[model samples]
Target: MISYLSASYIYPVTGPVLKNGVIGIDPDGLIRTVLSAEEAKNQNIELVTFYEGLLVPGFVNTHCHLELSHLKGKVEQHTGLTDFVQTVMKLRGADDSAIELAMLRADVEMLENGIVAVGDISNQAISSGIKRGSPIYYHTFLEVMGFNPATAKASINRALEFKQKFEGFPLSIVPHAPYSVSAELFEELRLVAEELPGPVSIHNQETPDENAFFERKEGGFLKLYEFLGLDIGFYEPSGKTSLQTVLPMMSDRQKTLLVHNTMSSNADVVFAKALHPLLYWCLCPNANLYIENKLPDVDMLRATGVKITLGTDSLASNTGLSIFAEMLCLQDNFDIPVEELIQWATANGAEFLGISDRYGSFETGKRPGINLLDFEEVNGRIVLGREMRRLY
Candidate 1:
């Protein structure tokens, strides 16, 4: 049996930090045993040290838009959410070959960043190249958008057909966003989600604009609709809004994932958590900042015992797809522990996608789809110091 030992901090999610820890991985990728360095040394185990870098599990990004990969720096000039929406829609029907290349490149970028999995959102039209064995494992959330009941049926049918193309374990049909989808369309997706066996993801409360549009038919989105010649009569502002209205409509078997709730308050988070503590919140900090220019109230969300995870939206709204960059953005704001942050991007991400049984943790019998990082030095000297360089 091949056993690998490492002296790095182990983040198993439910215990004290095992300082100077040694984790053994047998021939099977599953973790054979996790022991202290001294204990492993006493047993004559061969050790490969990762210096001071924590040997945490690979990151799990819970949301991203791979199809928008080609528009890396194209939409930045747009002023508000509505304007940005127009810009994306304008490019809606692009050449198939060009779009495919950017999508493939974006996929490769995420894999290189130590991301073993993702919760990706798609219009389902681009359902050709994305599959299980491609770069990183993905839970494809087929998105649909329509303003009237007439278009709703067609939208839902297309989404369902697209989702069926994936004859794999990690995939599902889900809404695109709360605002873009009309209540009629949302209800249709709800019925589809009800029959789905897996979890569902939605862009809820992503911005104050989305909340305003849904709750009052006012905000940047209203202006965008007026400019685009889309009618806004079906809009009925529910003075009260949250996933509560939407969740109950979906299948009980499927867990709901609320993405980009940057506008959700402490009370909003508390109520949602109490309703379903298992519900997950996907924070696209970089994407939020890039478009609407704000991140979520992470402290409030975490305090509510809600599950929170990170995502690198896509090249459209982000410079690149890197879980490390996303986690660093979190550190730039929240005073969270390194291990917990690691869990948010790794185990928690995998669990949300319902693929935790395989790739999340580094244990025996699991696929070692593990990724190692290579640090870039500024001047032939490590910034963190040579003693604290390599990390598993």
Candidate 2:
């Protein structure tokens, strides 16, 4: 049976917004068509009017670390990324039961916030069970890391074993970050991607210290290696930015998502686009503020005309797992339009995670999971009032 849902405005994402729109959906939730209220009335169609909010497609969280949900308030805010990483490593192994429960709660919270799909990062198989029974679609990135070149092969073997535990799920063995991954490990990931194709997400330029270490071989990362009791004897500075040095090691054949990018420059962005045409820039603004008290130069990112997506990172680095909250943070700081933010949170993310066919827009035959972005009209300007409500 066909049903009609009417709203004041419907953002199709793929097409123009329909004013006083009526969306026709089948019993199974597939969108049949979208028509204006007048068009529906002319056809003598019944409509179920939702008196408030703008109807939109469910959000896609393009980057997340589901396993780190237990570390919500464990680490203090405004700590640098190096200290944050050290604290996580020290405190993340407290209790298995607690970690599992936290992951479960985060999954439910995202579903409640109208997150229809996720591109989650995992260093281990701890989140496998949660994703197995999760209502939200997840594309797991089996993240592997090793700063030492000698251990790169061993690290890939261990990652392969971890990936085996997550069989029957959409998984990709990917590098963790430029600071944590050696050149050999990146080549290993590229070779694995040749066998099983998928997009790769890496923590990129989260701090200026990362680029500093790559440029002149002197920075906080030197102290970080000392703190971890690791030797950097074989390591050599490339005299370039961290992203510029490491991106060459990545596969141009596969699509890549550069997460964070808190310190990425215009030259780096241009180099990335030239290196990999299928590159995507992911912004986790809240997480950037939490760790470094700063945000990426979003204006520069926008100026590049690069496809941008939004991510919540993890509870450890953010207050919550809501894409709407992330967007609000950007809006408050950057003054971006709400419509453009919606596209970043929804359509661009879906395309990156390879779930666009069913999740991006409310096109015909797509079950995009209708969402209501509730807002209050304040002095002729629309202000988002509350958390997003899932309508389907």
Candidate 3:
């Protein structure tokens, strides 16, 4: 049997909004068709369930760390990136049961927030079990981090073995970040990424120090390296922004997602677009504010016409894991269009994860979960309320 659902507005993301749109869905949640209220009435469809707010495709979170959920509230806020990293390194350990329970809770929290799909970062196999049994779709990015050039091969080998733990799930091996990975490790990861079916992700220039370290071999990160007792004496400054230094090492054919681009300038965006054909910029606004107390130059990124997506980062750096909250944060700060923000939270993220075929928008034969947005008009503009729920 097919059930019909109608809402105040239907945002297909890739298409124009439909007023009082009725979407027909099968019991398995596959979309059968979408029609206007007039069309449904003309067809003599009498059981249409109507709602008072917008209907949108479920959200897609392009970057998250389910493994770090147990660390919520353990780290201080607005400590800057280097200090935040040091705190996380010290507090990332916990009992296995505590970690598992936290992952389960975080998964349910994402589902409750109307998130249907996620691209999560995994450093170990602990999250594999939770993901295997989850109803929400997940694409795991097995992250590899090594700053020593001599450990590059060993790091990739370890990641290869770790990939086996997620045998039945969609996954890819990727580098952690530019500052934590050596040039040799980046090259090795690029070769592995060439064989994978999904895109690569990395924490980009979250602070000025990230660029400073690459440009002149000086920054707060030098202290971080010293704190870890790693010898970087052989490393040389690239005299360029971190993004520029690393973009050339990545394959132009590979799709890459640069996260937390808080310090990325317009020149960095231009250079990356020119060098890489497939690229995505992931914004985790709340986490940026939580750590660095600053937001990205979002206007510059929008003007560059780059493909943008949304992420919640991790519980370590955020109070909650809701893409709706992320959207509201952006809207409050930038006053961007609600429709554009919806695209970033849904379709654009699915595209980056290569799951657009199944989860991005409301198209026939797709099971993109249904979501409702309660909103109130403010000064003739639609301002989304905090009450978002999954309807299907």
Candidate 4:
């Protein structure tokens, strides 16, 4: 049996918006069809009215740190990424029960906000059980970072062991970032890519100091190392942007998701795209502001026509885990269109995570969860209101 849901606007995502649109879904939540209200009426389909909003596909969060859900409100805001990393390193460990409870709460929050899938970052096997039981589809990236060449082999071995611990889930081993990973570690990542190809997500160019550290081996990152007591005497400057150096090492066989990109320029996008055709750029606007108090050059990124996706980072660097909040932040700050933002929040992210077949857009045979984006009229244009509801 098919049931119909009608809304003020229906963004099928893969197609044009239908004014007073109706979507038909089967009992299993798979979309059966999307038609205009007049068409549905003419066809004698029974429709349920979802008053005053746009019905969209469920959000796909392309980047997150579920293991760090326990650190919400514990890490200070606007500390910059270097200091933020150090702070997380020091304080991420708490009582096991507290961490588990926090993970459960964060999971519930994302579900309430209509998140259907996540590309989560994991350093250890802590959240594997939670992810297995989650209603949300998860693709875990076992994050590995070793700035020292001597420890690269050990890091790869340990990351592989961690990957084995998540034997039943969708996952891949990936680098944490360009700055924290060494040349040898990147080679290890490449080997892993050759052996097990999947989507990869990594932190990128969130600060000027990251580029400085790569190009000249001098920046606040030096201070970060000093703070951590890391001996970087064997490291060499790449004399190029951090992305320019690391992106080339990635496997062209795998898709890569570059997160944050707060400092990525046109040249960086062009260079990275030329190296890997399957690259997707992910933006975490709220988390960027929470840590660095700056946003990516979104206009520059838009002009390049690179596929972009949205993420909520983690509760550690954000107040909550709503992609709606992430969207509002973009709309409030940038000149991007709501249509493009929705694409980033949905289809593009699902593609990056390799779940687009069933999660990105409202196509027949896909159970892309439906969400209602409640809106209000402002200056004669529809804009997102504070109220959001999950319809299916």
Number of the top TM-score candidate? 3
lDDT of 4 by residue, 126-211 (tens): 89989989999999999999888888999999999898889989999999999888889999888888777998988999999999
Candidate 1 vs candidate 3, TM-score winner: 3
For 1-392, candidate 2 gives per-residue lDDT tens digits of: 88889887888999887878889999888999888778888888874756477899999999999999999988899999999998998888968899999999999999988899999999999999999999899999999989989989999999999988889998889999999999888888888988879888999999989999999988789988998888999999999999999999988877789999999999999998888888999999999999999999999999999999999999999889999899888878886766788899899999998888999898998988888887767677666666678887
lDDT of prediction 3: 0.92
- Per-residue lDDT tens digits for candidate 1, residues 169-237, read 466777776666667787777676557768888887866777666566677877777877788786678
Indicate the TM-score of model 1: 0.88
Off by over 4 Å in 1: 1-3, 26-28, 47-50, 242-248, 371-392
- For model 3, what is the alpha-carbon lDDT of residue 126? 95
Segments of candidate 3 deviating more than 4 angstroms = none
Cα RMSD, each candidate: 4.1, 1.4, 1.0, 1.3
Deviation in Å, model 2, residue 308 alpha carbon = 0.6
Q: Could you tell me which residue pairs clash in candidate 1?
A: 30-363, 30-364, 30-365, 31-363, 31-364, 60-345, 194-251
> Which structure among the candidates has the greatest lDDT?
3
- Supply candidate 2's per-residue lDDT for 249: 93
Q: List the residue pairs that clash in candidate 2.
A: none
**TM-score list, all predictions:** 0.88, 0.97, 0.98, 0.97
TM-score for candidate 3, please give it.
0.98
Model 1 global lDDT (CA atoms, 0 to 1): 0.70
